[model samples]
Structures are given as structure tokens and as C-alpha cells.
Target: MGCCTQKCQQISTFTIAAILLGVGISMAILWNNIFINIRNKQLSVAHDTQGFKMWKETPIPMYMEFYLFNWTNANEFMNNKWPTKPNFQECGPYTYSEHHIREQLTFNENDTITYKTRKIWKFLPEKSKGKLDDKITTINTILASVADTVKDKNIIVQEGINFFIKEKSEPFILTRTAEEFLFKGYDDPFIELAHKLHIKGLDIPFDKFGWFYDRNNSVDYDGVLNMYSGVEDINKLGRMHSWNYKSQLDYYPGECGRVRGTSGELWYPPLDNEVLEVFSPDICGTVKIRKNGTILHYGIKGNKYVAAPEIFDYTEPQNQCYLPKGVHLDNGVRSVQKCKFNAPAYVSFPHFYSADPSYYAGITGMKPDPAEHHFYLALEPITGLPLKVHAALQVNILLQNVKGIDVLKNVKSTYFPMLWFKQTAELTEELSSLGKLLLIMPSAGTYTAYGMIAFGALLLTIGFYLMFKKGWKTIHDEEQLLNQQQTFN
Candidate 1:
């Protein structure tokens, strides 16, 4: 009875060890999966802060390099200086500016967060080229010339008054002593005329023209930049709405003028070759996906341009996102006719990446090169935050023939390129650490989990092998001794 009990005890011990081994291996794998999912959820939750969701309150600094087109020799086209119209040519680097964009988030009573941004623009005079100091004088002189020509033609005083913005019947120069101030409308004739035209039921194109100075002269901290971001469904990501121009005369859907979601959603883990469209409430259309690969940026090969959330809109205006009004809306050329920016000029991407081929086909002095002038952005896919964003845009003045102004009648109605800018924003060290945690740490954890599973399996196999050795060797030795005893007898 003792022997039989011993044998049954050994068998039970082996069975228990086998069950434990299976459970340990199974539990290790199950626990690994559970922990990995927990980590992902934790990562997602980390972005959810007190007021802002998926956004941090860190201050980001943006650097901008302005490249002004040298129109000094534009009239030389008539003189046959070279060939073709000299409206846009020889765009060279001009000046540099820095903007300290401060963003604040406030949670409203209705489960919504109000996002406010204040831009403190500082012009670096040391880095400026050409005639930065003389810009005010130049604009005033141009207005005066237009006014003089209009008067000579005996145009209506109403139109003449609107044509030439005058503080007191004389051209005014916009000047600012400080670099940063509250956002205000510029004292520009174009903007004033646009407003007047709108009241008269004429949808003429113009933006909020103003000098880069606050209306009060003294900085107004309460003057926060007002921009609204939609958040109807918290289940999905929310995108910023198009910025409304304070001086917008009338809404023109044909112009495709909204600017907030121009480059698509800030978040991306886009599918391959996905066509991403800009978000414009006016024009229902999509911007062509110029480049869909991640090779545009080094160290980031997973990011690609994809369709924005607005593409799913079912209505007419919400369905399409056209590029702009004047330029070919089929492509992605920017049209300032409806943008209503603070300037009396048009702004668009350099070389017009997705613009119509004809924009540069006939122009001799201008050629659009995507390799040299393409906008580049690198975003971390996991967090949907921009790792590095670089945008290059060209600013041009529309030179069209007015009916009464003799000086403008002979000129071609074209967007004359004035200047272009390359704005860049990079992630700081603090933000970069967050990205590393989101991207690197998860991968490391996965590898570690796999290693643990492999180790557990190895340990189980060793345990079973040792048990077999002990039991089989002992039985074999006893059988050998019994056979020896029988032979001896």
C-alpha cells in the first residue's frame, strides 16, 4: 500500500507540474496581449488632458522666411528686357520673421473646449533684404498713382474715393512701432472697396487689409484670435474650421477661400496613395494628393497625405473642396480672391504644385519645380501630432485693368508675384519625448512581451525534460540491477 501510494503521488505531481506549465505559458501570452492593449489605451489616454483632448498646452515657436519676388523689372517685359510677361520672376530670399504662437484652452460649460491662439510676430530687420523700411512708402505711392490716374480720367468720386484709401484725401502709410499687437483690419483701399461693394450687392474680391499693427496701438491681451473647431462627435477626431476673415464682404463658394483645413487633417495614419482633400466650407472639393510617400521627409517613412474628415459630408457645399476661385480649382493652386487675408494680395504654394499646367506653360521667366519648392510635413502617426511642418507660399498682387483708371487699363489682369514665404515649425525636446514614448516604447514593450513568452515556453520544456529524466533513468537502473541479480542466481 505504501509503494502504490508513492507511485500515485509521483504521477499526481507530474500531472500538476504539466498543468502548471501549460497555465504559465498560456497566462504569459494572455497577459502579454492584455498589457499591450492596456499600454495602447494608456497612450491614447495620455493625450486626453484636462481641457484639451489630444493636444498639449506647450508653446510652439514658428520661424518664417519670406522670399520676395523682385518686380523691379516687371515693366521691362514691355521693353523686351527678356521674354514673356515679367509679372513673376527671380523670386529671391528676402526676410525672416518669428512668431511665438501661444495657445490657451478653456473648457466650456457644454463639454466643449475653446481654443485660442495669440501670435506675437517679430520681424527680424537684420535678416531682411530689399526695401522692408520703404514698404509703407511704396504702397502709399502706388495708391496715389492709382488715385491720380483715376482722377485724370474723371471717374466717379464714389469709385475714386474707394479706389484710393485716404485718411484725409491723401494716401496714408501704415506703420507700427512694436512687433506684436492685437489683430486688426489694415487701412487698405482694397479691403474698404470690397466692403462697400458687398453692401452694394457686388461680390468683389478682397481681404482684411491692414498694417501689421493693432488698432489700439497698445497691445491688447484680451484681443484673442477667434477660431472655432468642430466637435460634434467626440468618438472621432475633430478638425479646426476655416478661419473667418473679419473683413469678409460676402461669402463666395466659388472662390474656395477657407484656410483652416487647407492641408487636410492634422492627424494621419493614412492609407497608401490616399487622396487627401482640403476642408473648405464654401467650395465642396478636394485638393489633389501631390505626393503620397513618406520619402519627402527623412527619418519618417510612415506618414502620407490622406483624405480629411470633411470628405464624408453628404451635402453639396460640404462634399467638395476646391483649390481656390481664380486659379484652376481642378488643381490645388491658392486663390486669394476669396481668402480675405489681412493683405490685399493673393497667396499660394510656391511653384503651384497642383496648379494647372498653363500657369507656367507660357511664362518664360517662371518655372514650377516641385523638388525645390514643395511643402514638406512629417507627422507622428500614433499621436497625430506634427513632428515637423514646413510650408512655402508665394504672395502676389492682382494687377487688373480698372475701367476708369488709365494707368491700369493697359496692364494685363494677372496675379503678379510679390513675395513667397517658407514657414517651419519643429517639435521641441519636451514634445519629442512624448513622441518617443508613443512610438518607441510601445514597440519595445511588444518585443519584451514576445521574449517573455519565448522564455516561458523554454522554461516549461526544461521542466518537462528534467521530470522525464528523473523518472525514466530511475526505472531503467532498477531493471538493469534486477536482470543482473537474476543472472547471478
Candidate 2:
């Protein structure tokens, strides 16, 4: 009887051990599956006719609002002597009706996707703060005697014929061939003025003026232009089926100048002078990311390195922008003249975050408050998605010496701030939910696995302890004590 009982007890112990081993393995496998699935979701790319399509999950289609910098001191710029100080005031934060459609469309088996993007300008009428009569008067004065009949129409132009008007009317498109979309310059007013002069049989000699002569005369294309993202990764342009399962987070370099990096992930270590370089098609150059730790407390949040308001006061670098390299006539000017597109004027960040002291120093009526005008982007590290984005760029005309352009002759060599714009995007609840789910899953699984392992070990330990202490002796007692047997069992 003792021998039979010993064998049975051994069987029970082995059975329990086997069960625990299986359970531990199962939970570990389950945890792995959960983690992989979530990672795959972040790297998902739907194959479509357009090619491989990928974008931020939140906000459905990404939203972009542009705040244009209207030149408040236009009269002073045009009329004042050469090298006069130019004053630009922050104007309309015009909300674009269009949403971005990014597609890495494949044409062949090699997975070459022609990344074609298009933006439709909404026909919404823009609101202006004060009258820009000063700007209109300046423009009319410059084109004196050439188009006499059109001078009246140009002076009385209701809409300010400036960067704001150009953005409103221009079609935003990007293609591989174009690489970057080049502005057609402020040609709308000139076209209207020219047409009016033609009606009066006055053939205005536009060729005589250097500004009009060298200006882009080609009809502004409303369709998308063929452009390149300038990425070293050939896979970025397109990828094969083998690349499908791989990470598709970085489709293209961000449009917000170059400092955004090829990853388009702005999250960085919280350290001073931590510089990050990113590609920007607009600036036609690579830009460096300037770190100001005041944006947010940096760390992992929701399975990603995100700068949230709960972690900090506000989103990373709110309402702020950074200065670009002064490639144009110096003083931190970003000139497109040196670019392949040969753009006329210069471009830079508004308020000049890292600009040369001369850019704002001794300049009258210029308010460059770093706190207000700087650009910042709050990025989620793991997913490489920007929860909150702000990109600010200023367009300036490099006025020095041009023979035929009479207006530019009197103007001194200055990186005049023509206009600047801020592009912004913020996080929504839907995205936060997604992020939180991803953040919670691994922790929950880990804790659950640990608990199960501990419980299983405890059960095994207690069983062994009793088996070693009471062993066959307890069975022997129970068999002898028949009444006790029922209680023991």
C-alpha cells in the first residue's frame, strides 16, 4: 500500500511541473505575438494603385494651417533709402481647406514608386487686418510710365499683391522631376496689369525691366510637379514586395525645411546644442534642429518618445521656429538663388531664432521675440509622428543692384523680410488612444506573465515542501487512522 501511494504522489508532482512549464511557455509566446503585432501595425503600408501609402493615423488626413507674415512697413521699404530697415508683421493664420495625400506609387516590379503629392488651394477669401494701401501705392509707383493705363488698377488692387495672395492662388504640387516646387514670383498683378495695358494698345516694354525680364514667365502649373525627396535610401523612392514587411515609417523627408532629418522624427536627447539635421525641399537645403529643452520633458510615453503637456507645460516648442543657414547675401539669409531652381529672393525663419545679430540689430520697427516667433515640433519617438508641428519660414528679397529693375537699384543690399508663415498640427484624442493602447499592452503582458510564473512557482514549492515533509508518512497515518483519512483527503 505504501509503495503504490509513493508512485501515485510522484505522478502528481511530475504532472503539475509539466502543466506549469507549458503555461509559462504559452504566456511568453503570447507576449511576443502582442508586441510584434503592435510593431507591425506601426510599420504597416497598404499597397494601392498609387503605390505604398503611409501617413499619420491621427487627424485622418493631416491638417495644416499657414500663418502668413504680412509686411507692415512696405511703404518704408520701397520708399526709404537703400539699406532701409524692413518691418514684417504677423498676419492671417489662413487655414488651408486641402489635406495632404502622400503615396509611394509603384510603376514597376522594382517597386519604384513615383511619390506624387498634390494640394488644392481652397477658394476661401482671406481676411486682412489693416489696409495695405502702402504696399499697393509702392507697387504702382515702381511701375510708373511703363504701363500707364494699368497703374490705376494696380494702385486700387483690393487684395494685397504679395506672398499671401500668391499662396492663396498657387497650386501646391510635388513630383520627382520638379524635386521642389519653385514659386512663379508675384506675377499675377503684373499679368493683370499687362492685360489691361494691352486693351489700351500700349505695349508695355516688360523686357526692359530686369525684375520682369528675368522673372518666370511660364504659366504657373496647377498640377503637381515632379520632385525628389533627396533621400539616400533608394527604397524611400520605392520598394519591392520583400521590403513590404519592413518599416515604412520614413517614406520621405519632411517638407518643413531640412532640419527635420530623413527619419522625420524630431525627438532627440535632452541636451544643450543637440543639433539634428533634416531635409527641406522648400529651403532647397539641409536644416539643423536646435534643441531648447523648455518644449517638453523627454522620455518614453505610449510606447513612443513623446513630449506631452502632462509631462511638461505645453507641447514641444509651441509657436516657435528656428533660423536657417544664411546662404543668400549673408546675415543668415536663406537664398534660393544658389539652389537648382534659382529662386529670386531669400528665405529664412521668422523672428530669426539663430540669425546674425545684424539681422535684427539696429533695424527699426522689427520685433524678434524668440519666445513668440520660434518654431517647434512635438514628435512621438517610437512612431516618428509629430503630435504637434510648427514650421515658420520667412521670404525676403535680396535687394542690391539690378540694372533694368529700377526699383531694386535704390534699395540697398538687405535680406528684407517679405513674408513668413507658420505651419501647425496638433494631437487629437483618437491618436492618443492608439498610442496609449500600444503603451499599455507590453506592460500588462509582462506583469501578467510575471504573476503567473510566480504563482506557478509558489504552487510547485508548496507541493514539494509538503511531499518532502509529510511524504509517505502522512499516507501511512491516514491508512492506519481510517477516521482521519477522510479529514486528510
Best by lDDT: 1
Per-residue lDDT tens digits for candidate 2, residues 369-488, read 564456565544444444556656666544343333334345444444544555555556675666556656777887777776776777777667777776544466667789777778
lDDT of 1: 0.43
Among all candidates shown, the one with the greatest TM-score: 1
* Decoy 1 TM-score against native: 0.61
lDDT, residue 465, model 2: 79
Using Cα atoms with residue i matched to residue i, what is each candidate's TM-score against the true structure? Answer: 0.61, 0.58
Worst 10 residues of 1 by lDDT: 173-182
TM-score of 2: 0.58
Model 1 RMSD to the real structure?
A: 8.7
Shift of residue 96 alpha carbon in model 2, Å: 3.2
